[model samples]
Target chain A: MIDVLYFAWVRERIGLPRERIETGAATVAELVEELRGREERYQAAFADLTSLRVALDQELASFDAPLAGVREVAFFPPMTGG
Target chain B: MRIAVQAEPFDLGAEVSAFTAGVRGAGAVVSFTGLVRDEGGSLSGMEIEHYPGMTGKAISGIAAEAVARWNLVDALVIHRYGKLAPGEAIMMVATAALHRGDAFAAAEYLMDYLKSRAPFWKKELSAGGEAWVAAKDSDEDALKRW
Candidate 1:
């Protein structure tokens, strides 16, 4: 089981901050595809992968990154921090 | 190096003073504070959301990079999340070095990385409604200089 977290507008669109998911997807992109098939809200939140950023186990990662032993994954829009 | 991620407001003057006093041999100290600007008076406040488990680690990693690259004597980063009012302090970065150039450059480097690399997201609340602030391309461009 891996914890999937969402932030900012992604959280607003998905209506949750985090969730536990059991999946066999090998990559982040595959996991996103699985999520998109689950619900329309997930589809909308992830409609454009270009506008979203992904993190694996609290570190920034690419969609092609493997999910091997990762315990946490976060999806969010580009950061606007300062 | 000192990194603080908290919801409570911090006093910029006190923070700067304390950081300045802590650096023993540094001849120059540079500090930058970011404030919430209510452009056109439309913005009422800001709501900052961040990844709780990653915020501190990300900030410290950036700070560590700045310290190594600039050979800084010391560095401090303090960022606040949650609701913040217009004109209130949102965050600050302070750096101490042997010369002004290193201090200034390191502070700017820290700011640039923090703007695009940090996990914090800001939502501006106005009379019309609330919306997440999109990351500016200029901010990402700024990172290329370093």
Candidate 2:
């Protein structure tokens, strides 16, 4: 089980803040594809990957990266680090 | 190296003191606190939203990068979320170093990066209704100078 979290516009679009996702996906991209198929809200929220950023277990990571043993995945916008 | 994101208000003096209490040989401690500003009734308040785990890591990464780029002994940042009233504290950044120059420069740099790169979004609450504030291009330009 992987904890997936969303923030800001992503949450607004998905109508959810966080969820525990059980998946057989191998990578973040695959996980995203799974989400995109869940509902229209997810599809709209993730429609443009170019506008989103992914973090695997609180570390910045690319979508193509493997999710082996990953515990958390968070989707957000390009971080404006403070 | 302290990072916090909270909805409750923070005491500036206490936070700064806590950050510098154990540090020795620090000649200068520079701090910046962001507050809610009244935009002539254009805004009634501000709603700060952030990614939970990602928010901390983002701030930490920026702090780490700033420390690596500048000669600073330590950095501290605290950003608040949820609803905030006018004149309330929004965020703070503190840098301590052996000299004034590094402390000041790094503090400013960290703030600039924070406003533009962090995964936090703020909405301006006004009589006109809440509107998500877009990322300012000026902030992006400011980061380019570094």
Candidate 3:
């Protein structure tokens, strides 16, 4: 199972901070597509890909990156830390 | 190197003094603090959210890179999350080196990376409304220089 995490507005929109799910998706993009199909909230939270960033196993990664052997994935907007 | 991600406010004076005292053969120590700005006098507070599992790891990665690249004697990073009042410190960075140049450069590098690369976000609560602070294009551009 991959633990999917969300933060900031994404978490607010998704209505939960995180969840664990089993999936057969091969890439992050495919995983996102699976999430987007789950409900309208997921669709809305992911409506704009450009406004979102993804991390695989807690590290920034591209959408096309493989999800094999990854245990965690996070989605959030661009960070405003300092 | 030291990295702290917590909800507790840090004492900048004490942190700097302790960091400086702990460094070996360091001639220069530089520190930078970032405060919660009440822009337009509307911001009452801010909520900083960060990934629990990634924050320390990401910061350690940045600090490690800064230490390696600048040959720094020591480095420190402290970031606070949860509700914060205006004028309160949001974060701080300190670096130690044999000379002022490396210390200063490393401090700047830590700030630059911490701004965009770290897994933290800020939401400002103002009199008018609450909004997430947008990531400036300039912030992303700033990373290219390093």
Candidate 4:
């Protein structure tokens, strides 16, 4: 099981900040596809990969990165911090 | 070097003083503070959201890079996440070095990375309602300079 976290508008659209999911996905992109197939909200949140950023185990990562042994995955829009 | 990611507000003066107090070899210090801008008088406040586990780590990595790239004597980064009123400080970065050029360049480098690389989202609270601030394309362009 791995924890998937959504932030900003992604969380608003999904109505969740985080969730534990049991999956067999091999990579972050595959995991996203799995989530997108789950429900309408997930579909909306994961619709545009271009506007989203992903992190694996609290470190910024690419969607094609492997998910093996990773405990957490986070998705959010581009950061606006300063 | 030090990095702080918190919801609590901090004093800019105090922080600057503390950051530069013990420096023995540094001849230059540069400090930059970011504030919540109330443009056109519509903004009432701002809300900042950050990934708790990643905020500190990301900032530390940025600061470490700044120190190494510029040979900074010391560096400090403090960013606050939560509700803040207009004109209130959102974050600050300070860098000390042997000369002004290094200090200034390092400070700008830190700002550029913090704006795009850090995992913090900002929502502007205005009379109409609250809306997430979009990441400007220029911010990404700013990264090319570094």
Write the residue-wise lDDT of candidate 3 on B29-99 in tens digits: 99999999988688899999999899999999999999999999999999999999999999999999999
- The true-versus-predicted C-alpha distance at residue A52 of model 1, in Å, is 0.4
Candidate 2 local lDDT, residue B77: 89
TM-scores vs. true structure, each candidate:
0.99, 0.84, 0.98, 0.98
Residue B69, candidate 2: Cα error in Å is 3.7
User: Could you give candidate 1's per-residue lDDT for residues B30-104 as a string of tens digits?
Assistant: 999999999979999999999999999999999999999999999999999999999999999999999999999
Best-fitting candidate, measured by lDDT?
Answer: 1
Q: Which residue ranges in model 4 land beyond 4 Å of their true spot?
A: none
Stronger candidate by TM-score (1 vs 2) = 1
Ranking by DockQ: 1, 3, 4, 2
Ranking 2 against 3 by lDDT, winner: 3
Model 2, native contacts kept: 0.57
* Clash pairs, model 3 backbone: none
Scanning candidate 2 chain A in windows of ten residues, the lowest lDDT window is: A73-82
Better of 1 and 2 by lDDT: 1
The fnat of each candidate, in order, is 0.94, 0.57, 0.94, 0.88
Candidate 2 stretches greater than 4 Å from native? A80-82, B13-23
User: For all the predictions, what are the DockQ values?
Assistant: 0.95, 0.45, 0.94, 0.92
Model 4, B61-140: lDDT tens per residue? 99999999999999999999999999999999999999999999999999999999999999999999999999999999
